[model samples]
Target chain A: MAFSLDTVIYMDNNATTRIAPEVLDAMMPYLSDYYGNPSSMHTFGGQVGEAVTQARQSVADLLGADPGEIVFTSCGTESDSTAIFSALRTYPEKNHVVTTRVEHPAVKNLCDNLETLTGRKYHISRLPVAEDGTLDIERYKECLTDETAIVSVMWANNETGVLFPVEEMAKIAKERGILFHTDAVQAVGKIPINLKDSTIDMLSLSGHKLHAPKGIGVLYVRKGTPFVPFLNGGHQEKGRRGGTENVASIIGLGKACELAAAMMDEENTRVRALRDKLEKGLLSSVPKAILNGHPEKRLPNTANISFEYVEGEAILLMMNQHNICASSGSACTSGSLEPSHVLRAMGVPFTAAHGSIRFSLSVYNTEEEVDFILEKMPPIIARLRELSPFWEED
Target chain B: MWEYTDKVQEHFTNPKNVGEIKNASGTGNVGSIACGDALRLTIQVDENDIITDAKFKTFGCASAIASSSMLTEMLKGMKLEDAKNLTNDDIAQALGGLPKEKMHCSVMGREALEAAIADYTGVMLPMAQGEVVCECFGVTDLEIIRAIKENSLASVEEITNFTKAGGGCGKCEGRLAALLVESTDKQSSPATAQKKKKRMTALEKIKKIEEVIEREIKPTLKKDDGDIQLIDVDGDFVTVSLRGTCAGCYSSQTTLKEYVEKKLREQVLDTLIVEEDK
Candidate 1:
């Protein structure tokens, strides 16, 4: 299954990125020679523990947070769960949570089952989003109350790549004495974040999303945030998380974060341009192709477009023939009768939601790859539209 | 990913028999845009009741489009009676089986085929006469019951997977669960009851009435921020009180009779009568 860059145009970076070669090289020592337990009371293990500490520092520097605040976990989903569970345990009197309706299932499903988690009834206020996939901040503020334990929102939507004003929202939550957690798995590397100047109590980031390998994630806790351990086994992660360290992935993620900090400008400039060109090309060439998220206030590397009358899964399968990788919000792709919850929450019309395609770029994507996708997308869409019963030539 | 079979992929990629047949003998349409899928089927039947030609147009996902394409292919040259008897499972098997969640797409195909046959024959199908149970999908009680009985479905989730009922806002889950229990009970009992109308003991009637009240009546009402409480049961006369938001609503009587009473009579016994306790 080894694929060459020449053979495939990988535009699904928002789903997961190809591991950076430098990150792999940095992780090799830990994977092979330096495999001693980080907690062992010996020099060999002490060296590994020092590597872990430096990795923590690198991740902290990337987010502009204190090194002590970064606690590594298995993935973004686990980090999200830990943050909310910690807040709920810390504030035992509160029995309500506020979040957006468009959150990834990691947070949405967790909030939906909070009663089971806490063994008591808990109310959840899911703020609705506008057609542009942006939240109504006024509605979000209205949802906060004395019974609200925490407000969990994603920094950037995974489906639409629409950025939320989490910094402002977090500040509002702080003024109300409510803990705030942001799932920044999609936002951490794609945007500039300086948590030192922000009131976000907890932030989650996944490694594989930004050129690191999978199985490594960071949950940042502001220095004085009240905390309780989600995992209560061994006293690892300063008793905040109880599992043994995922050492190799930790090192890889540190390298990835350092690289992300170095390439932030290029990502905004070059990757952003590629994304725009692909979007514009598809919209102009393909009939009934519409953009999904907010026009300007979105991630630079992501573009979601919907081709009416054609199904997204069918469009993606056609793209697969050209080795062009992308994702869709189509019901067929999900194996469910409905499309992505994000699109449905946005009130995107039924005709468009079923055909939405998400193309997320990375620093690795090229102008050539963008052109290739632009070249291939129009005819594929036209062909499917011809097959579609609803499609009519204009 | 759905792990679609090779047959499914072939049908989805290069779907056959697309577009509408001109001067079709019969046509059937099912689903809606808001429901996320729709199909329009056309067929030309000869004087001998043989399908001479078939065509389809679909607006849906892969399985939906493929289901439509597969249905048209299955209908061409098929006898009208044989086509009328086609089941959703038959459509799925034709395409080497759809995903469990996508079974509803096949069900849509079968339903559209039945509708088209009805259109040609000028006879109303039983489903048209059945009460609407799932507003989201326009699935009827007869359709849900048929799917459950044919597939031996035991849960609301299974019913959703098979028929797309309760898959939307989920306001119909209680009704779906009741239908599941009802269908399962009918299957377990012998056909002698349907022929002889067996009588039940007083305790048996009370237990059956209470079970329907708790399982079928309360949940569907609770979704609308309403509740129902059983007051007393004596012989065929059952009394209940509407609590919560349902207590003073103008439609409480209608809810009591149309929904509560209808469900009790269907599930417990046909002679059972429900009265609102003022």
Candidate 2:
């Protein structure tokens, strides 16, 4: 199966997406002709500030937030850091944080090193997930206490696409007077988000996860939320974030958000159907294959399947041979000796955890591409099973 | 992604001799699913003690599968005695070269081969008799020491890269560091004893100190954005200045005594004393 690069099928949108053509078109002028410092006093640069304001408004509209609440940052990690750090800074006497065990490294690592980073000993309650990768709200409620400063959880897991009850969790934390943050990097555009109806105080989103360029992100800080600036510089972002505006990527993100809003319906209907087709085809065709996350509470365009008795790196490399792109949670793929922390926290067995593959589709994926994957995957699994020591004939 | 060699990609894409041989003379299975990679190797030895046929089945990453395939290809028609002497380095060399982190794959191949040979001879393997140092991969002290000696490994990071000893929960890192020092001490003792018989002149001592500082000490410091310059060599006291991030660092004294001085003592003369220049 010799395929040209032009015909490559991409299904790793959770890792990153191809920049949308509309977004590129919107950003071209900003990159070449409209190159101006948004902080400059002159109108030439002041005009760029207007575009930034519009982008902020567009982002807020998508999230059902006020433009004043949106603080543009470098990326999702920066947003996550800023949100958590701001909460910690707001309540210095509080020494406890509530989070989930299956968080992305951006949030997980920050929570792990909070004591070292802040020079104060802090207790972290990392709430565990169930076998199907859903959080227990009862357990989440039990973790919050008077000493808890904030609760941080991801809206959707990047590896399994498992959706957490972040809204309910946020409401519970709000009743306790604790700040709540959600890393919505994977969930922002894939699912419906109305932050106005929700109790989440802060939310983090990355531009590249959608069809926008990288290096742009948004941290939604609710109005009147006690805040401290992570990066203190000039009065850019009203002194919230102190960096020169990433003029072009910010504009591109705005265009991408507008496009995502219009395509959300198709994302949940058409793209989700393709994901289901691919998932069902692989699980039914490949023996001993199992679904990794919650069957229905997951992202619409994501499927994580584990082909037992095989290694994920081998599966991914074989998939690469067919110009099919995906990601894996195997220890070998990550250069760590342990499998994905998310899968492990969900109690996924080693037999499946070592071979988990995540296919995160985007609106750009076609049914034909899904069919092509279905056609190519069974043989690939069979070939690898033939070479696997633990694989048994059914 | 790993920068796999063309040969590694070739073997992984189209692996040869992939299967289990029925009623084989000897069969060896190493690793497990929980550890993320495993290999089962079988060999058929003729009456002449030559491996007539060899095949393998592996559950692992591309490098592991490629290593097993390359090992089987290298094993076919080789004498049992020659196979006994084969090291993991030989398997890696045969496959062009594996990534430093993926070297454990070749190590797995060698272990499977050794187990197979032990089964053929009905002898218990000595490497298996040692205490398990890395519970994650079930690697033993004997295996760790052998990897260190064979590969000239210097750090815990390298041990993890080669044998996967401290790659897991890393509870065994302290044990691995002790084992490393034990192995390197044993390796250098004989040479140290031999060198102790001769007394070096002042010029020779200074030259040897300078060489060690440049070749051994500088690179290690530079990794941490630090540098060292040899200032003076008076008798056994070698004066050096720590530059860059090492300058004015609170842990510089510990680095000087534990790392720089220890390295100088091992590579140059055991009596050499290193002092930070005031």
Candidate 3:
């Protein structure tokens, strides 16, 4: 069995990705050689601290944000927690929070835990998502009440990869004097994010989800936003997050950010082309596959689709056998008996929900990999459907 | 992801007897567009009532495809009687095992088989005899009972997987619970009948079920911001209703199978299987 060099495709970029060698190279020195704590008052520590500051500037430079606004946390989840909790704490007078039904589990689960998380009464309105997985701006506007503390929406969805009208949302929130936060984990790397151009109060981004290591993230809090720290221990992160910095990871994240700044062109061109190839090939090759998510307004590297009658996990497992990695929207994959909220919120039929699969590409992916996936995917779907009971009747 | 058994993965990867058989003698189709899973089974029986070929098409998760594949493989050389006797549990067992949640996949196999049999015989499926229970799956009484009797289903979830019953908005869970009780009672009643009757009258089952609902069940659930509406009563059959917040609650299946069935089994009959009014 001969395999071509081009056949290895890594389509699941949204889950996580391989750290760029350059980012790893930038981090190794901090990991092994410069072991002194950044807080220690010595040349050795001061140098490392300066490097952290430089790294902060590198991250800020990419987002069109100020270095002081970038608060490095452990991961995107932590950043999300910080942004959401900070909003609620800062505006205790406001009892309501506004979010979308299609947010990632980090946000969705927190919303679900609001009753337990808050000691007092707090109301949260999970705005409905449209059939294409985008939040209805009109409905989102309608949901904003005078007592709303925050309007938290992700800039781009992780599952559907559907881009939200975040600027409009932030503007609406600002007009009402409500703070806005966005879980921009998926958007920061793939899309052009200019903080100077938007009224977003707090935005969250993760490192590993980009090319950096797992335990690093950036929470961009625009200069004068009402902020209360979610963590309380010391004066680290300017009383934002309290912890000894993960210096190596932070450096890696900074380097990754720099690489992202350099690679934004490839994302819009090569990565998008590959994604389109993968999407178009799968849809055309397969008999009854339907693409999920917004057609034109989604992440360049992500494509969610449903192969009418075949379940997603089944396809993922089949793909796993060939080392062809992918993901699914089946309840079996989400650890809930129900399907992914993102797909369900879009009102995808139940018969189609289990069959949903997500193919998220990245700059690292090759054209040959897309073709290989194109070759393997339709057959997998075809085989699965053949055994499908629905297929039998039809 | 679920802690899927190795057995489950194997069938998912290499499903057997996939594709539709042209001019197949009978086809069984079960589940619906909303239930999230649908299975179709086609069989070509030779002159001897021996299945010469079986092909399946399924629209669902891995467990479903694997179950249908396994069912097709299992039935290819078997007689129709054995296939009729086959339950969802059997299909899962044949595949080594499945996740507890995926146990319904095997039940879908059995359902598709029964539907195919009904289509082949041009007879009404026993499931078609009662009201549709799971609005999401379009499951009926006969389907639920057959699932219970064949798989020894004891929970709402088990019924859901096999027949897609009580897997939707869950309004019918109360009715499904009542059905479980009624069927189980019928199964366990023959010996108690000193009158030498092969089965209890549908009237007797309904009366006993109503008495149990009025005495033991209705008052408790109603207090918890839930209400039960009894929909129908037929031979060895009883249908109750779920109202208020319970009607729209997702865990209605739990209340129906766990609370309702437990009550009916305690007061009415031991082997009863509840079916929702679709």
TM-score-based ranking, best first? 2, 1, 3
TM-score of each: 0.84, 0.86, 0.76
Local lDDT at A3 for model 1 = 59
Worst 10 residues of 3 chain A by lDDT: A1-10
Report the Cα lDDT for residue B242, model 2.
91
Clashing pairs for model 1 are none
> Worst ten-residue run, lDDT, model 1 chain A?
A120-129
Q: What is the docking quality class of candidate 1?
A: acceptable
Candidate 2 residue-wise lDDT at B213: 85
Best by DockQ: 2
lDDT of 2 at B32: 93
**Candidate 2's interface RMSD, please?**
10.4
User: What is the DockQ score, from 0 to 1, of model 1?
Assistant: 0.26
Per-candidate chain B TM: 0.68, 0.67, 0.62
Q: By DockQ thresholds, what CAPRI class is model 3? A: acceptable
Decide which is better by lDDT, 1 or 3: 1
Model 3 has a clash total of 37
lDDT of 1 by residue, A1-394 (tens): 3458779999999999999999999999998999999999999999999999999999999999999999999999999999999988888877678888899899999987887777965656777789999988887876677778999999999988999999999999999999999999999988989999999999999999999998999999999999998888887888889989999999999999999999999999999999999999989988789999998999999999999887888888889878999999987676556789999889888889989999999999999888888888888888777766678787
Q: What is the DockQ of each candidate?
A: 0.26, 0.32, 0.26
For candidate 1, the per-residue lDDT at A143 reads 67
lDDT of 3 by residue, B137-255 (tens): 56666667767776677877767765666765555677667666765776643223223222333456677888888877889987888888777753223456688888767676568
